[model samples]
Each structure stands twice: as structure tokens, then as C-alpha cells.
Target: MKPFHHLYGPVPSRRLGRSLGIDLVPHKICTYDCIYCQIGKTTQKTLVRKEYVPVMEVIEEVERFLKEETSSIDYFSLSGSGEPTLHSKIRSVIEGIKEITSIPIAVITNGSLLYLEEVRQDLLYADVVLPSLDAVSSDAFLKINRPDEGLSAERMVEGLVQFRKIYKGQIWLEILFCRGINDHQDELIRMKEAINRIKPDQIHINTVVRPPSERWAVPLSQKEIEKIKNIFGDKASIISEFDRPPFSLTEGNIKEEILKILRRRPLSLNDLSEGMGIPTEELERHIQPLILKGSIEVRSFGESVFYEVVKEIQISRP
Candidate 1:
């Protein structure tokens, strides 16, 4: 299948196998200007939810992809650029996808907007909803998420609990933290109390593995993370690299796909490897020359390095 502009990454996911990412909102358009965000700062941080992308238009792209070619994708991920919930027509998109195929739908969100009944209702159709809760305290929330005026952390937590009570879906809550900020014993205990309210099926503990918008958003060590995992208990686990794609794309096409994706936005090595269905080792061989020739460059976002087009490459199809 040809690359769709709005559709990116049947990217390898650590938890959900190969995932086809559907970009509902434009780049960095989100509710939280999160300190640990891998993709960097938010350009529009708002509480307003609108039809960010035409829902029917994207459903058409999905139909084309599913009908034209076989995808090894385990799920269709409503995650790209920003929060999927902000797209007002996401419920329609989910419904439209259900009409086409039975593959499960997953949405990765910040959980900031989940407090709104409209937002929570819009996501009821999804099989999996992954939302993050980095801080439990108001002061910590402001320092971490940097949300808009009137957007309270307390309200967000209340919303999550309320949504959980009504919705019968998997809620895999993500907790992204940095050192000395929200990783202390007191902070961790408060987080546990807050998490109990949501009662997620799983607690995904992640850190700033990629370069973040804020340099101060440091990651906890593997040992430190594991120690905290014990405190958080059985449901808590670290999100790490899991399996490789079972298939591979033939030579020549891999580079084009990588270029096609990066032309839209920068991606980490793992993102490139997963999306292209190519091994990182082989991808590195092709990537090194592109970087050396000034076709692309590696940029660090936390500890993870991502590849983005150098902008002057004058991308004309060979």
C-alpha cells in the first residue's frame, strides 16, 4: 500500500505489536506541554476539542490500506503528533473503523481531557485507552504538565476515576516521571493512592528515554525504576523494547518509507525500525550515509536519538 499522509507508523510498539498510527491532530497540538514529552514542546495547549482532522477522510485512508494490502498490525493506534482525544470526531473514526474490520482500536492520550464527559464518551468504543498520570499533586502537575489555566490536576484525576467506573475497557495508565521531581517516596505514595482511584488494568511505568522538551526532565535508573515497581506492586511494569517485526520490507523501499515518514516528522531509531519493518542494524547502515551526506541528522530528545530530515535535501523522487 502507498504511504498515506495522515497515516503513519505501523510502528513497532513495546506493548501492542505492530501498530498503524493515525494522526488525528497536527504536530504538538496537545493539552499538556509535558516536560518529558519525547516529541518536544506543544505549540497549542488548549482545553477546546474540535474536529482536528476530517474523520471520514482518514477512515477512507484506513479502508484503502486494509483493502489494498495485508497489514501485520496487531492494532490501529489513534496516536500521532498529539493527544487523540482532542479530535472531536474520534468516536466517529472508531465507529467507521469497526464498520470496516474487527481489529482492536487503541488510543494513547495524556488523560488531561478525560475529565470531560464528552471526551470520555468519545473513547468508549476503543479496546484500549492508555492515559498518563505523571503527578498527583497540583504543584507537581503544573511543574510537569504545564497545562492551561483552569485545568486542574484534581479534576483530571476525578475524571479518570469517573470514566473508569462507567467504561468497560482496558485502562493502561502510564506514569512518566523524572528524578527529584515526582520519584521520591512521598510522591510515589501519593501516586499509589491516586492510581488506586483509577484502578487501571495495568500501570505502565516509563521515563524520559527520548530527548524531552525540558532538559531537567531526567530519567530514573533501571534499578531505581525496578525498586519503584515493587512499591507500585504486581500490576506495575516498565515499558521496554519487546519483539521485532515478524516480517521485513525488501531493500530500496525501506529508505523511501523512512524518508516519507521523516518528511512528516522526526522519529526515533525504534520508531523508524518498527514503522519500516526493518531491523535497526540494517536501518543504521542506510541511515549513517544519509546523515553523513546531510540528507538527515540525529537529534537527541532525553536519552533516545531520533532521525529527522535536514530540510535542505530537496526531496525529489529518484
Candidate 2:
């Protein structure tokens, strides 16, 4: 299979299964520079919405991949290195892909722009919309998310609430906790109140399980997160590791395939093994040479070690 410009991964997702990621915007162009972001710090933080990537090009690539590959992807995920809603023609891209395949579409967003009618409308066709609400108070929101100017915590909550009223699809609201930042008692109470108003179909509680952009961003213990999950009520659950059985790594060169997936996000040895359907011992053989050549580097977050491609290295076809 040839390299695709706007498409990536049928990578294992903790939430969406084997998700084929569609990048609508460029890397790090996001509204919030969240401290716990696994993909690193946001480079171009903005509220402005426009066609950052060509809509037709993205659609064409999806069509090409569908024709060339026979991987059983669970969802066509509108997520990548940056916030997807920033792409003005994302609705067009979603509609175009739906026309070609029966696969469900999922939109993973920050929910910052959901206050706008257009943004909410753009995501209506998606099978599931996973939007995050880490904090309900302005101070906590600012500290945790570090959003662009003019965006407030109240507006963010309101957007989710408004979207719940209109969207018939599933709304899985994710709340990522960073130790003391948004996990305080006051913030938890306010977040619970906001969740009541938003009425999301599911509430996924997450801690910083991956390496964060800020070193100070720390994760809560499993026990602590479970307590918060109880507080959020019956609908809430912790976002755990992807536990599904591995899929066969059909077609692509193993070395090139590893780089392709790692370029989008850091994955542990087990994550790569599960996503690639290869054994850890065999993967280490391919990984060691890359590490020696400085093509990829290892990072530890909590107890898990992850591999990420060095940003400066260009990914040329093998």
C-alpha cells in the first residue's frame, strides 16, 4: 500500500477499537494546549476555523485505502495530531467517506467549539462523538486545558449541553484528570453538576497514562480514579487499556508500519504488538535498530514505556 497523506492508522484505540484516523488539520493546530496531551504541546493554538487540509484530498485518500486494504477497522475516526473540528470542511469529509463505506464514524474533539451551531451540525452524522470536559470551573479549566483566548469553561460546558439536545448519536464525554489540577474536590463537584446538565450517554474518566507535554502533569492512582468514577454515577467508567485480541498485520513492511503508527502517537511495546498483531520479542528486534539510529526514542509515563518517532526524521518509503 502507498503512503496516504491525510489518513493513518487502523491503530488500536482504548475507546474506538481499530480506528482508521483521518487528520483534518495539521499537527498541533488546536484550541487547547492541554498539559496532559500525549501528542506534545500545541504549536498553533487558535479558535479560527477553516479548511486547514484539502477536503477532497482527504476523501480521495480514504477511498484509496478502502480499495487497497482489507483491514477490519471499527471506526473511521476524525482525530489525529490535532483538534479535528478546526477543519471547516470536516462535515464534507465525513459525508464523503460515509458514501463509500458502511463503517461507523467517530469524532474525537475537545468540545471547545461546540457552542457554535455550525460545529455541532458538522458532527451530527458521526456514530459517536467523544468530547472532553476536564474541569467545570474557570480556574481549573485554564490551568488544565490552557485554551485559546475568548474561550471559557462555561461556554465549553454549554456547548456540550446544547449538543446533547440536538445530536441523536452517542456522546461519550471524557474527563482526563491530572493529579491536583482538575481532580480537586471543588472541581469534581462542579464537574458533576455540569455533567448532569450535559447529559452525555457515557462518561469516560481518564488519567495521564501516557507521557505528557508538561513533566509536572501527573496521573491519579487507579484507586483514586475509581472513586471519581463512582462519584460520576452509573454511566461513568475508567478508560482502560485496549484489551481486544490482536489483529493480523497483513501487507505492509513491519519496520515501515511501526513508524507509520508511532508517528501519530506514542505506543508501548504491548500497544504496538496488539495493534500490529506481532509478538513483543519480534517487535523489539525491529525497534532496537531504530533506537540505535535515533529514528525513535523511548518515553515512560507512569509504569508504561512508550515509543515515539523523532520529529525531525522524515518518513521515506522503504
Candidate 3:
């Protein structure tokens, strides 16, 4: 298997099956330099969406991996080192993948630019969309998300609400709460109202699980998480990270291929594209067979999407 630094995982996900990740943007090129970001602060923060990396390059990588005949992947996710939507070619990448495979396409994002019609249009082809809303109040939003100047809580929520109206695919809204930050009663109540307006298929309530940039960012206990889940009502659940069975990559030993890449660190689609030198369209082709055999899964961390090994079929080590 050709290794790339950009894409990581086919790691074990609590949500989607062993998933194949695609990173469309470069490192930390996001609109928000969130306080609790796992990848650290954004070095270049902007709302501009452009072709940071060649779209055809991403497509080729996907196809190559798919042709490798690996198994044990589920979703073909668009994510990575930075905000995916920031890449102007996002829509084309999605379209290219759709041409290559029938497996569900997922996009994990921060939802900052959903207010833009073009941004919403770019997301139209995805099977699932996961976005984050960390705070309801502007003060808390600035402190928690540390959004770019002029981005506000109301605007972000409005964007999500509008996306909810037109999007036909499954919407999973992620809420990452920081202890003593956005977890207060008033914030939770306000968040509940916003969620109602968006009406997503699932409400994924989470806290800091990985090493974060800010020391103040901490994971909520299961008990505390459950409490927050209760506030969101039945549509919500606390994300669990635990042991699962090995996912089977029936073709070309996909689990082995994905694991070889993930052994270094958690990676994104952009990571894979750059690392593998395979076009994104080709990458999608490589991932489709694996998804059918159930080797990978997809999960959410705020707006980020990650791939994990499925727990059923056992995969041999590469």
C-alpha cells in the first residue's frame, strides 16, 4: 500500500463503519481557529474557499485505493487537516466520487459558510452531513469556537437552519460542550431551541476526547454527557469510543491498507490525497468495494469526519 501523510484512519468509529477518509484542504485552513481543536489552532483562518489542492489528484488517489480491492470501509468522507468546504473544488470532488461509487458520501464541517448559497450547493451530493454548533451566545462562541472576526452565533445558526430546509440527506448536528463554558443551563436551553429549528436526524452530543490545543478543553464524563444528552432529548446520544470487532475488508485487504496509513496518526482525506498521490476520484473507487464489505466506519469530531475499523470482520495486519 502506498502511504500518504494527509489521510489517516479507517480507525474505529463509534458511528459510521470502517470509513475511508478524503481530505480536500491543507492543514488548518479554516474559518475558525477553535480553542479546543484537536489539530491545534488554525494558522490561516479565512472564509475563502479555493482549490487548495488539485481536485483530479484527489480523485485519482481514491480510484487507486478502490482498485486495490481492499475491504472493510463504509463511507467515503470529505474531510482532513482543514475545513473541507474551504476547497473550491469540493463540489467537483463530490461529483467525481458519485460517478465512481454508490457508497454513501459524507462531509464533516464546521458549518461556518453554510449561509453562502454556493457553499450549500457544494454539499448537495453528500449522503450525510455532520456540522458543529459549539455555542449559542456570541460571547461564548468567541471564547469557545474562536471564530474568525465578524462571524457570529446567530449567523452560523441561521446557516444551519437554512441548510436543514433544503438538504435532502441525513443531517447529524454535533454539539461539543466545554465544561464551565458552553455547558451552562442557559446555553443548553438556547442550544435546544436552535437544534429544534435545524431538526437534524441525530443530535451527537460530545466533549473533548482527544488532546486539545487549550488545556481548559476537557471531555465530559459519561454521566455528565448523559445529562447533556437528556437536555437534547431522545434524538441525542453521547459518542462512545470503545473496543469493537475487526472490520473485514474483503477486497485487496482494505483493512490492511487503511491501517498502514493510520498507524502514523489520525489523517484526513486531504492527508490521504497528498500522501498517496492518488486522485480523489480514484480514491472513491478504491473505497466503494470496501464499504460494501463493511470494513470501515465514519465518525464526527465537531465538523471533522474520521474513519474507523468496523467491529465484525477480522482484518490481518499489513
Candidate No. with top TM-score? 2
Cα deviation in Å at residue 169, candidate 1? 1.2
Q: Model 2 reaches what TM-score against the true structure?
A: 0.97
For residues 1-318, write the lDDT of model 2, one tens digit per residue. 668988888887989888899988899999999999989999999999999999999988988998887667889999998999999988998899999999999999999999999999999989999999999999999999999998999999999999999999999999999998999999999999999999999999999887899999999999999999999999999987776666666433778788889998899999888877788999999889889889999988778899999954544444
lDDT of 1 by residue, 1-318 (tens): 466867876676777878788999998898888888767789998877899989888999999988865547789989888888889889999999999999899999888888889988999999999988998888888998898886888998998999999889999999987888888788889899999889999999988776678888899999999998898899999997746645656565666667767755677887777666767798998788788888788887656788887655533343
What's the lDDT for candidate 2?
A: 0.90
lDDT of 1 at 249: 60
Error of 2 at 232 (Å): 0.7
Lowest summed lDDT across 10 adjacent residues in model 1 is found at 309-318
- Model 1, which residues run further than 4 Å from truth? 260-271, 300-305, 312-318
Report the poorest 10 consecutive residues by lDDT, candidate 2: 309-318
How many collisions between residues are there in candidate 3?
A: 57
Tell me each candidate's TM-score.
0.92, 0.97, 0.78
Model 3 C-alpha lDDT per residue in residues 1-318, reported as the tens digit of each score: 675444555644556655677878877888898877866678998988789989888888878777874454678778776899988879999998889988788998999889888999889889999999999898889988888886889999999999988999999988888788898889899999999999999988888765466767866677888888987899998875433444434445444555555443444554444344445466567655556776555555545555444544555443
- How does residue 6 of candidate 3 score in lDDT? 44
